[model samples]
Target: MEIITSGRLKNTIKYLRALFIIGLILSIFFMLGILGVLAYAKSQGAPPLAVPQTSLFYASDGSIIEESHRGQKRYWVPLSEMSPTIIDATISIEDRNFYRHNGFDYKRIAGAAIADIKAMAKVQGASTITQQYARNLFLEHDKTWSRKITEALYTVRLEINYSKKEILEGYLNTIYYGHGAYGIEAASKYYFGKSANELSLAESSMLAGIPKGPSRYSPYENLEKAKSRQKIILNSMVSNGYITKKEAEEVYQTNLAFFKSEDLGRERIAPYFQDAVKKELLTQTNIDEKTIEMGGLRVYTTLDPKLQKVAEEQVAKNVNPDSEIQLGFVAMDQYTGEVKALIGGRNYEESPFNRVTQAERQPGSTFKPFLYYAALENGFTPSTELRSEVTTFLYDDGNSKYTPHNFNNYYANGTITLAQALALSDNVFAVKTHVFIGENSLVNMAKKLGVTSDLVNVPSLALGTSTVRVIDMVNAYGVIGNGGQKITPVFIKKVVDHKGDVIYEAEQSKEQVLDPNLAFVTTHMMTGIFDAKLNDYTRVTGQTITNSLTRQYAGKTGSTKTDSWMIGYSPQLVAGIWTGYDRDERITLTAEKQYAKKIWADFMEEAHTGRNVTAFKPTEGVIGVYVNPDNGKLATNACPISRLTYYVKGTEPTEYCMDHVDHYEEVEEKQPEEDPDKDKGWFKKIFDWF
Candidate 1:
């Protein structure tokens, strides 16, 4: 050792004293700064920290179909509801000295700082569970000195204001787990398809490993990385005395059943209907999108789960999965306008475009009822006769001509009654009626009956050239089904807040848009469509409506080159079905399988299984009378073909048919002014006498 002089010893001592004083002043200033931060945070008061809850959608039968939330899906639960294994695992991995610390783990922070300094980069985080909770709740996730100080002060406040158990519960509930899941409850359910209390040791370890770097250790994203993190968590658990080494090893070796992210919402019974309800919630209430996503409102809808299931099954049974055919089906209570079931597409997962509420397609002859209703609203009756021969209509300043033709080009080519025209779906008769009663009248009638789609004022409007949505079509038919009462289709029945207070409730609205007698008469005319032979107009020979259903219901069949529709209603339910390709390509439905009608019939038969078989009762001012089918005149004993037809009281036929006579004496007496069949040949004259 070298010998030290007195002057050098004195100088070294002075330098040591000066360094100690400087360190002492610096320590005092740091303590004062920390105190200032704590005081400021305390002045700011306790943070409003709560986990986001999931909003639930329930069917009319009180079964949950969907749980919707924004940003992250979270389900808050008490700490006692969590598996003890999860709590132990989380502690072992996140903050081993959590119970012993005040707010920050000073020893871990020091170690992490040293490690980060050695690496010459900020590669480590020293946030405890409480510190994380503070940052997640009150501070932005920015790696800045001011943010860190604010987080530390908030962490201290949280420790002072809450118990160790509360802080841990909050931290576990608010941490972001990968795959849009938050909280142990949601993560456990998402990963294991079970509640937190039912999570096994392996699942708990897996979830505990996710919080460190959720995306990095997401089993859905990287199975190997997640497994590595899980193994590390198991080792930590064993080292921290939570479990034995053998137990940890056994858990590490155990296979974990992971949930498929694709199947996250598979339990949702009717996603398209749920989507409709979600949209309606936004439109019908003052609830903002953010609040609706986060408020955990219980949306109660009028979706009859049984009917919805039937609708889905019927569509699946009828539509070929391999084919490009898509279908839209809607069923609703006729009087209440409550949508009981809705199938927007065959599979909502493949496409979420809801056809029922979104798609606007040509309604074809199914739109004839609105035209006929308009005619009846005017001074026309079912007994009114029109020539159903080929006719041409000029439009667009006579630049284009449209000649309507019946299916298979089969027309009566003579006088056909309104009832027969509708039953036969005679295109010429409908076009004549559309022209007789101006296009404005038909458009107005359609609007009043709930055809919300644009109805162009063209002659082809009689043929449903304009487009309309399935929901609007069902609602319009529901007008006739409900005996002339206009009803708005209602899906959501009620919505309640998390506290079970009624936030929104649907009220039934009804407007009498048509005369009850006219509606009844129109419905009766539609009933004739189901008849195998309408007096003389048979239903397309080999294609009879009788083959579709044997029920006492009224409906119309509509088809375009590419689209086919069957919308009908009994007094109880109104249902509509549409089938077509997604593209504008034609589809030739086979006679053996009329997909729309078959689907409708099957669903309707089941839907009416337990309900009463009530017939449509005619309202007052509506009367039935027999008329000659050939000439649409009052029937006489000599008339060969006669059928009973309904009419609005004052519109019934008053003149008897003069085509046939009972005897020669009656014929001569009735035709004294001219010889009967004078222009006939001698054989026909003798035949008339005989």
Candidate 2:
């Protein structure tokens, strides 16, 4: 009885032990299934993809300047819009069994395991598109067995949770192709300068092959390796029924039709203007520098390519090519104040300094217009005149006196009109006018014209003694061009984000800075300055043309020792030309009008070839009546000589030259010709006598 009981106990122990082993195996499998379910849920809902922001620029004509961003980036494209070649090539090269496998390819895994064991002796890696996305989106860039296992697990979960097409689309949008490229759309523009749908089979194959290793297979860096990779891709395409074998061979034989990394067209257009626009973009959008250079973006600008070309050619031709002296130019739309053409420096590579906004030089007589405007605003008219004579200033230090002279170094010998003084750029007349009106008025007027630099409130401010930038000067002139409204100079019209969303729209704020009548009066005075109306007293050769030979325009000439400036506006365009040394050295010993005016004329002639010749109408409160040179009043036959001056209504001279009765009579200019070979104007002879 005892032996039978012991046998039963031994049998029970064996059965219990067997049950324990079976349950352990079952529990292990069940835990794995639950983990798999959780992983699958996580993969199906991988965190939303991260995308970098890109900024784009546009011109006045609504053209792109620069797109700001950096990345081997993708632009989101719908499946319907994606090219069949692109879709097929990507699938063939990345994952042949992409459609058949759940995200994790077990067959590939087994093969890769054997390959890895063989490669562990060396080095090897095989990753499917889903696995790559899993790594790119969630995993670190670590090549560890643990990481590999996680990648496989996530890839499988991705397949279970997402559709084949959905996974493919997400992968395409999220993959990094080397050269800072991201998506198919971005890659298309970066490589081909077109949309992804427009990519050719050869182009698609080249792009498709980039996934193996973008840097290694980049056509730009290693064309031969890229071709080899392309061939492998082509074979896969052929085997997968994506393309015919003959077609693949033909494509393989053809030279890689790689583009010049996009923008072949932009290069052929306004490169300098485009560069300026980009600089403005850097300031407007706080994008990272690396992204701007590597991230492909489409920039639109406000430049007129045709005008930009003309402006460039004119500057290159007129300015000394080898001279380090920089020139800054800006052309704007009269109505909108959009900067159309700009040249920042002689060469961007040599000197990155932008003279347009950076350098501040005296506007010289250019400042007189603002003084005149102030006079007009404070109750003056185009017919108003100020006494043009020898005037000396009394300073706090009585011993130190200030006496201003005209360019010709002679007082008008008697009273002269304001129109004549401006046309002649007479320093004496302008200084007197500023004194009468008060210096602060001139400063305020200048500020109204967009002068941001400090203004020396001394008497010399009337002669453009304060420094101002070329851009500011041009913008001030634009006030007259646009009647009386002040339009802020706009280089960037709009900025768009990478998603084609408008991030910043241009706000071209314009406000009335001067009375319309005053602006007109100022323009009217400038017109005669260029019309040779003061020819008897001054030589205004550069802007002066025969009425029959002339196209209607308005302009002003300025000289301040080292610099010479000529700025003008036709009905169609406003342009300015400045000539000076970069070191502030005098370009010529003597201030000459010819150099600046010639450059201005040459540039304007070419710029306005196809454009209409427009006229500036005389605004109200301005009149074109002639005045006596010897007396500041409406001209008469009895007046031996006359000069026309424009003024605001009440500033017209109420009295003629009273202090100097014999001033005109005492003038002696009878000098025997010392050199018959020396050709001189009558005014030159007068100077020789002095």
User: Model 1's lDDT to the true fold?
Assistant: 0.84
Top candidate on lDDT is 1
lDDT of 2 by residue, 525-633 (tens): 7876655546545665334433322476677888877778888777777877676767887666332334566656766777778777667776666555556543455
TM-score of each: 0.69, 0.77
Question: In the order shown, what is each candidate's alpha-carbon RMSD?
Answer: 11.7, 11.9
Residue 572 of model 2: what lDDT? 76
Report lDDT (Cα) of residue 642, candidate 1. 76
lDDT of 1 by residue, 617-663 (tens): 88888888888866778766677777888888878888777789755
Measured by TM-score, how close is model 2 to the native structure?
0.77
Best by TM-score: 2
Give the least accurate 10-residue stretch of model 2, judged by summed lDDT. Answer: 664-673
Q: Kindly state the number of residue pairs that clash in model 1.
A: 0
